[model samples]
Target: MNKIISALCFSIVALSVVAQNNPSINQADTARQQRETDQVLREVGPGDSVPSLFSEEDADIGPQTVLRKKKPTWFRGTADAQIFYTDNMFFQDGNEQEAGLAVTTVEAALTTPPCITRFASYRAEVGYRHQFFNYFGSDDVLAVPGTILTRRFDAEDFDFDSSTAFAEIVAQTKHYQFRAGFDYTRLLGFEPLR
Candidate 1:
């Protein structure tokens, strides 16, 4: 009985030592695992060729071409004329006094692009207006104290002319704007002066 028990223990110890010394079993197990993984991959089929998320082809997707608008010119101007006629002039108290009036106006302006370093813009403008009145009548005399009142039949005294010139500089930013300018006006043959 002792010999049998001792032989059994010896065999168990030898088997464990052999298992540790021999690496073939480990290699076989690894090989079997690799084969199983390959078989599973083959069954799954080639995964749909996933395109790169940041590929260069995607750069051309939006707004293939840009459209540009034309810019306007810097100078502009306008001119106009008007005519008026009446058989009975108001000053003649509804009498047969033919009257005619003509008016003309002209305006012009100029603007420049903003400067690079200071971001300032410049503008200049000028305007002119003229009025001519004609009346077919005789002169009238009035009685007054310490003053001579003489009214001419022709509308020469009623005609007027005006002109204006202006220049300005402006500085602007995203939030605010600053402007400075100078203007001059002239008038001839107005009622007060006449």
Candidate 2:
């Protein structure tokens, strides 16, 4: 019985070794693997240079170069005029001197562009004003010789007129401002008072 078992085991080992060493079976497997690789290459096609799948097309994208214009830096000027009047100009001490007053004023201003300097700007202005007063009441009361008795004078002595002109310059910075100006004034109709 031991000899029969040993013979059967030796036969099985020899069959397995013969099957592993067969050249025909190995050739058939190599042929099948080569065919499969050829079929996969055919399906994938040639590999020419191609655009990226995630990138935008040239026709669908907007223009890459654009032109823009700069803005103007200058500003316009300003002008103003005003007039005022009063029927009874003098009411002090309940005098009711029956005087008429009229005043007229005019002004103009201009501003310069920042093209002058980096931190400062400038502006200029000029102004003119006129005043006229008509007096119907007496200017003086002549008193009797140290007695307090008096006589009234004519209204022409009390009438008055005046005119004034002024010019100004302004300089401005980020945190501070400065201004300088001059005025010229003329008076008429009251030489004794002046």
Candidate 3:
């Protein structure tokens, strides 16, 4: 009698579990959830938009942002050499000395890409230049020193080389333009005059 009672209890519990997990019960809930999702998508429409903190007109108040698709920077250089004759080596009106000389000039620069915007355009550059003067027949002539008629010097005292370093910024607009720059030059062979 105890065995029969236990078998009956087990069968009742198994049937109750099967009824709770039936497919028909889940089908109705799935259909209701799918309908709600479709209704939400229809109400939102097909277009997409992003929310922004500021309006379009408010963005134009301060300095405008410069936009460049491609920034191109370049390194540039130039060299020049010339041989010339000068009748006045010292550039004196009373007594002019004649000489033959060669001049060589070299320049190099590095420039940043131009920054352009709706209101203005600007660029920055740094450069260096060197010039050398060689006097061939200058030694044959005599140079008069400053304020001393008795003192005479060789023409080689005027032969000198110079080096210059510079930096510049250029800016332009529709109605106005501006430029700012500075250059420093050093003479290599002018100590005798000092």
Leading candidate by TM-score = 3
| Superposed model 3: Cα runs more than 4 Å off | 1-71, 145-157, 172-178, 190-194
Q: Estimate the TM-score of every prediction.
A: 0.35, 0.33, 0.49
TM-score, cand. 3 = 0.49
Report clashes for each candidate as comma-separated counts.
0, 0, 0
* Winner of 1 and 2 under lDDT: 1
Model 3, range 1-194, lDDT digits (tens) per residue? 99999999999999999999999989987777665654454344234322222467345563333233233757878999999898998788866888888888999999887777657789888999999887767555655545556455566556789999989998988569889999999988834335
lDDT by candidate, in order shown: 0.56, 0.55, 0.74
Q: Write one digit per residue (lDDT tens) for candidate 1, span 28-125.
A: 88788765654444344243222323456456553222233235557767777777776655555524556566666677768665453334333433
lDDT of 1: 0.56
- RMSD each, Å: 30.5, 33.4, 25.6
Residue-level lDDT of model 2, residues 1-194, one tens digit each, is: 99999999999999999999899999988887665654453344334222322336435663232233244434343343433344444434444344333333333333344333455677766666565544443455332323566445555555566776767777887578888998888887744455
- TM-score: model 2 vs. ground truth: 0.33
TM-score of 1: 0.35
Ordered by lDDT, highest first, the candidates read 3, 1, 2
Which of the predicted structures, 2 or 3, would earn the higher lDDT when compared with the native?
Answer: 3
TM-score-wise, the better of 1 and 2 is 1
Highest-lDDT candidate: 3
